[model samples]
Target: MYRERPAAVITGAVLWASEAGPDAPPTRVLPDGCLDLLWSSRAGLLVAGPDRRAHLSRSAAGERWRGVRLPPGVGPAVFGVPADELRDRRVPLDALWGRAAATLAERLGPSPTATALAAVAADRLAAGGGPDPLAVRVAALLAAGATITATAAEVGLGPRALHRRSQALFGYGPKTLARILRLRRALALAHGGVGLAEVAVRAGYADQAHLTRDVRDLAGVPPTVLLAR
Candidate 1:
C-alpha cells in the first residue's frame, strides 16, 4: 500500500498510505464509539479517536489488543502526506495508539478512550507480555527526551535492556526509536517554521548536518524536502 496524507500534527508525523496490498487500513471505528486503525504495515497504524483521552497500542501478528487511555490531547493531524511514505516505514502500533488517544483527548476531553481503551489494552497486555514489555514501556516513557538512554533509564530499564526488548517487539532497538522520535520532533519544529539548526539542538542533534542525515534516513528526504511536502 501507499500513503498520501497531506499533513500530520505539526508536532508529529502523519504518514499517508493507500488501502491496497497486504498492507491495508484496519476497519475499526465507532458511531457510539469513534475510533479507527489505519495500518501502514503489520507493525504500525494511525489510531484515531473522536473524543476524550487518546493513546497507542502494539502487538505481534494476529495479536489481539486493548485500547489504552491517555492524557487528554489531540490526535495527530493527518491532512496531507503521500501514499509512498508508508512503503518503507513500520511504526510501532503502541506509538500509533498513543498518538491517537492523545489527539482525541485534545479534541474532545479526558475520556476519548474510555470504552475502546478499556476493551483493547487487556488483549494487548496479554498478547505481548513477553520479555519485550520493558521496551514498550520504555518507549512510552520517552515523552520528551532528546537522547535514548535518558528515556530508557526513566522507565527503570538500562539501555541494553531497552535495546533488547525493542529488538524483539519493534524489530529495532531503543536507539532507533529515540532517533525516530527526535527526527519527528525536528519535523514538527520545521513545520512550525523553526530554523533547521534550532530544530537540531532542540531535538538533541549536534547540528543541522546531523539533523539532515537523521531526517533523510527516516523520511527519505531532507528536512527542507519534508517541509515542502
Candidate 2:
C-alpha cells in the first residue's frame, strides 16, 4: 500500500508511506527533481538523492517505509550539501549528518512515521535558513514549461551562471530538470485520459514520438507501460 499527502510543515514537500507485500515487485521510481529523507523498517534513516533517470527500488518483503520528499533546491539547504554530490545515490543519513543523524535515528526509534520525517526535515530546513529563492524561481519556471533561456532570463542569470547554479540546486543543469518536469507533466496528462498525441502537444513535446523517447529516457519505460501502472 502507498499513500501521500502535502507536508504541512514545509511548502511543496510531500509526506509519504508505503508497505511492501510479500509478492511486491521492484518499483520504478521516476525522476522528479526531488530528494527524500527516508526511514525504513529494515534500513533505518537514509537519504534518497535526486536522480537523472529512474531508480529501481527493491524492497524486502513486508518492509515498511516512510519518507519526507523535499522539493528541488530545498534539499541542499536541509542536507547541507550540493545536490549534485548525492545524485543517483541513496546514502545513510549518517553519511551526511554524522553524529546528528545518529541522534535523529534514536529519536525516530525502530519504526518512523512520515510525520516524524517531515518534522525533522522542516526543522533542519528552517535552521539552514530555507531554500534559495533563485532555485525556487527556476524550478517554478521550468515546471511551467518555460524554456531554459527564458527561465534564466526570468531569474536574472545568464545561461552559464544558471547552469552552474542548477547543478548545485537540482543535481543537473536546467535543461535536464526541464526534461524531467516535462515528463511528469506528460504523464499526468496521459493518466488523465488524454490521448498520447495531444499529451505530447499539450506537454510541449514535438509529437507522440518525442514524448515516447523522453519518457523512455528518463523513466526507463515507454508511456504505455507507465500508464498501465
Predictions in order: lDDT: 0.44, 0.94
Instruction: Give me candidate 2's TM-score against the actual structure.
Output: 0.99
Positional deviation of residue 99's Cα in model 2 after best superposition, in angstroms: 0.9
lDDT of 1 by residue, 6-111 (tens): 2222221222333332333343111111123343233233444422111222333443222332211111112111212222233444454556545544553333
Residue 128 of model 2 has an lDDT of 85
Clashes of each: 45, 0
Native-referenced Cα lDDT, model 1: 0.44
lDDT of 2: 0.94
Evaluated with TM-score, which candidate comes out highest? 2
- Location of the lowest summed lDDT over 10 successive residues in candidate 1: 71-80
